[model samples]
Target: MEDCLRIAVAQIPVTTDARANGREIRAAMRAAAGAGARLIQFPEGAASGYPSGAAKAMLAGWAVDWAALREELEEIAALAAELSLWTVVGSSHALTAPNRPHNSLYVISDTGRLVARYDKRLLSFSELADWYAPGAEPLVFEVDGFRFGCALCIEIQFPEIFVEYARLGIDCLLLSSFSRDPMFAIQVQGHAACNAYWIGFAVPAQCGDAASSGLAGPDGRWIAQAPQAATRLLS
Candidate 1:
């Protein structure tokens, strides 16, 4: 068992263009490698961009190319293998119609394998509830000696999920969110303090007023944070 692990929280802007998002992800992976981080986490919808209400409306007219999205994901996995880094990133997973896709987190191992996937269990009533299907199972994976659990966006508002992770003996929680509200930081800190575990929060750089991508210790204090509106690698 390793005594310590180095992880990176990548806070970067995401767009509707999957190729552009892929480039950003590659760049973040390189930065994580340079920082000597073995694992990296990216914000929710990092690959597809968290569609706004406006974008959501446009989806009806826009035809989504699932093939291209899959290719981009493959490219990310290749990059992870080249850098020997594990990655946790958010992307949309397609489902058979008339079911909508899932808002999911992909766990890629150092070998570039898609080891696990975590879908957002709790759907927000506002935008996501109509767009995504709720996930029923929890996702937990391990690195070195540390066990990590996954969550997305509004799930932070629920304490039961965090409690479940604590019961499962996770040392850390990886959260990917697009929320720009100041309450985001407060909720995460409270969860960390209450659960007595480390937490990594990742949000898009363009998310105005969003709490910066940061890692908090078991004490619920920030150990590191990215600069406002800047694309940065926080470890």
Candidate 2:
């Protein structure tokens, strides 16, 4: 296992259009690959836009086209394979009728395989009541000797989750969010320091305007960060 691995944290624009979102994600993957990053972490709902405020009305009505979303995901996986880069993308996971979908992160390996999926377990009030079905399990995956745990927006409020991942022996935590709160960055840094593990915090470009997407080292210091209010990659 390699002792060092280069990972990219992406701050990209996410729209309601799956195709448009896929395009931006693919471009970021190419850039990260060019920068020699082995893995890239994207913001929550990078493929399918995250619903908020007025958008929640559309989500309550179940407006997403599941097929198009799946196609976009597959294309992203193919691109990850081509670049030999591990990719983590946030999207909605469809379930049977009468059941709400899950807010989740899809983990694609460098070999172009869907290795794992981490569904958001601790959802916000609106998410649990209307937008999504809460997930039951936590997820952890490995890359180049580094073990990584996955968490989504709002999960930052729960320190037990971070402690659990630490107990599971993960070296890093990948926390993806659709938040515009600067406190998100502060909370993630605290988690990194408490757990003695690196934290890759990815947020949408819109959110970056409030607090930049960044990578926090074990010492609770930023290793890299994207510029505020910009779509960029932090490697």
State the local distance difference test value for candidate 2. Answer: 0.92
Stretches of candidate 1 exceeding 4 Å from the true structure: 61-63, 127-129
Q: What is model 1's C-alpha RMSD?
A: 1.4
Clashing pairs in 2: none
Q: Largest TM-score belongs to which candidate?
A: 2
Q: Tens digit of lDDT per residue, candidate 1, span 1-235?
A: 9999999999988877788888999999999999999999999989876665456765663345678789999999999999999999998888898888888999999999999999998998854556788889998999987899999989998999999999999999999998788899888899999999999999988873568889988999988988877888886
- Residue-level lDDT of model 2, residues 88-158, one tens digit each, is 99998989989999999999999999999999999999888878999989899999888999999899999
Q: Which candidate has the top score in lDDT?
A: 2
The collision pairs in model 1 are none
Local lDDT at 107 for model 2: 97
lDDT of each: 0.88, 0.92
